[model samples]
Target: MAALMLQGTGSDVGKSVLVAGLCRAFANRGLSVRPFKPQNMSNNAAVTADGGEIGRAQATQAIACRVEPSVDMNPVLLKPQGDRTSQLIVRGRVRGTLAAARWREGRAGLLVDVLDSFERLSAGCDLVVVEGAGSPAEINLRDGDIANMGFARAADIPVILVGDIDRGGVIASLVGTRAVIDPADAAMIHGFLINKFRGDPALFDDGYRAIEARSGWRGYGVVPWLADAGRLPSEDAVILERSAMSTGRRVTIACPITPRIANFDDLDPLRLEPGVSLLMIPPGTAIPDVDMIILAGSKATIPDLAFVRAEGWDIDIRAHHRRGKPVLGLCGGYQMLGRSIADPHGIEGPAGTVEGLGLLDIDTILTATKTLERVEGIAGGARFAGYEMHMGETHGAGLAQPVGHRADGSPEGAISADGLVAGSYVHGLLALAEQRAVWLARIGVDAVGPDHGASIDAALDAIAATLERHLDLDAMLALAQRAGHAATNG
Candidate 1:
């Protein structure tokens, strides 16, 4: 099998989108393509068909390849629970928490498993598109790096360095990466691609060539800003800062942007509605007047609850609830809506119990075990398929008014007596058109949005077509083929 890795000059440089677009582009050519990322750091995760969890981006890429997502696509996932510590997931299961001081060492030991997953993933594939984490220019952490150049060198995969011209300093970022990284690591990069170019591609030809001339890498092509990229599920939380306000929408739904927000894409479908406006309320801003408020998933329930209170959003939510506005919570957000959340074992942080927003009568006890599964359920009389990924079990009288039921008829989620407040552990429910329509009707608006899943597939195809035009697909295929030949002969 042939493999090519895309490493960026820095984070949010469009490496994930590029890998995904290429996966679709190659798969469109009738190649058996698979997506692989040796390691990933993101709280935005997706449950796979094998009952495991991986980065959401890998799952999207799997969709791009028209394949089921598997844990082997991303063997090592680091879900940050806080600024200094992260929950480490290996092969789709949580291993333990990794501290900042031990991050380099902790990840170094996973190279064996990472490579093992890579081997298994590429075995039956014509091409495996690999995505590197962060940047190779982070030489200080390069000693035990398994996310970028280190993985490329060890796996003998060819690397294509990608630079974001929209971020400015593209010439310096690309050439400086080669200048700072170890010479051995630099040799792994076979070429360079400029991404997110706003204006005409020819306008940046001199600058693009300057990077190749300075770094001794060939130029693949310059890709203009892809409007369809916004339609795909984004893995980075930084994109939340760029959430634009939709004007003249009939209904508005607001979600507070918590520091440890996980699976924020749960609201992406709502953003697509022409009659709906999804507002992501950032920190220090009070929740504005809206038809509904959604408490999104959180990586650290206790800490994020504190953040909600600290930002005075708790006050805003209660006030909104008093006004008879609807409120919904998912996963950790559901935990935060409970009467209390106990973490005696310190699974998230210090061992203690914290009072919740008291929106629901249920109580939650954070446990060591995590639930990771893809499920189908009925909510609001609408059948929906989603996944559950959480660490707490919630129970209370509020559950008597369940929001839905599982396929086996087990009650799931809770609703308030007034039916204005609801919470569930299921993520991606909005992606189902029926479920989304039900929620829209609850907010007094008719759903006019297209099928969310179908829209995503169409967006992937559009992106593949765009990449085919801007990128040198034949050259890229030849490069990957050469790597395959080396792997076989070596």
Candidate 2:
């Protein structure tokens, strides 16, 4: 197979976005390209066109490739539910939960599945662009690893190490990775690349040479921080660390950052609205006064419910609703807005029942079976599409006033009697232009930007154009082909 993997110096070093950009850059050149990550640890997921679920990053990368996303793109997805346990979803279906110890012990066996998926994808693609999870230098966790260098060594895939100069000491980062990993593992790396460069590349001329000199790996071009990066969906929650509350937009929307928040990218579409100011209400801070209060989804609904109560956000939500301000909930957040949540089977952790925020007349019962599918519906008289990935089934009088109807003509979601509060299991409710415009009109705002999907499409094209000018795509493709030939000869 013609392939190469991109591994980062550390987590959140922009590996996902870079791989996505490279995928688009190569696809633009008329090559059949695909993106793969053997294993991923994220709660931000997207439903594939094939009626399966995968990490949102891979789905976005698939978009860059102008193809429908498949579950094989991300074979193993670990969504953290608590400190030492996560819900494992393999090939788009729930495989069950694994404790920290069990996960470490069983990860090696999963390599078979990961490789199976990779090989299947590689069969038809001209170039399979692989992305590695975390850093290869974390030797402590290298044993039985399938995410980084371990997978590269297993698949005989060449690698290009990426470092974040924007984080400083990238020269040290690139060199130090070579210094830390086994020499055999280092041999798998064909070159190094510096990413998120801010100023002129000339400023890092010496630094670039030093990294190449120390590691004996050729330097790929330095990529400046793409200002349009915000237009893309984010894979890491760390970006929420410094999420600021803006002051100038005509309408303000706030969502409290729950500890185990999932699919937070639902807020990305809000960024496209020039008249909207979006904010991530940080912990220890009370919910700010805003036009709308969104209860973001979480991987652990019960625990995050307790978390919301502990932070007194439940009180803030009630007060906001009393003031006649709109409150919207998606998935787990929808569960939280109900009168109660029952988890008798311990499906998510120590089985128990918890009281919800009681803003809406509804009850949710957690179950072992999870719903994962792409769906389209008409809500508030506007047609929109979204996905469902939840383990709870809600039923109550609220169902009578369904917010919408699914493609199958089944009732979905709910709008309160007064219509000031709404909740749903949908994740991408406002991605469509008309849907977003309707949402804004509900808040009495008369502004709506371009179609959310179009914005993302244009941004992908921009990123491809950017990489075409900066990165040496021709050389990278040549390197991948050369490696394949060398392996065949050997």
- What C-alpha lDDT do the candidate models reach, one value each? 0.92, 0.89
How would you encode candidate 1's per-residue C-alpha lDDT over 411-453 as one tens digit per residue?
Answer: 8899988888899999988888889999899888988777678
Q: Which residue pairs in candidate 2 have backbone atoms (N, alpha carbon, C) closer than 3 angstroms, thus clashing?
A: none
lDDT per residue as tens, model 2, 39-97: 99999999887667899999999999999899999999999988789988888878888
- Model 1 residue runs over 4 Å out of place are none
Output the TM-score of candidate 2.
Answer: 0.98
**Model 2 clash tally?**
0
Query: Which ten contiguous residues of candidate 2 have the minimum total lDDT?
Result: 444-453
Clashes of each: 0, 0
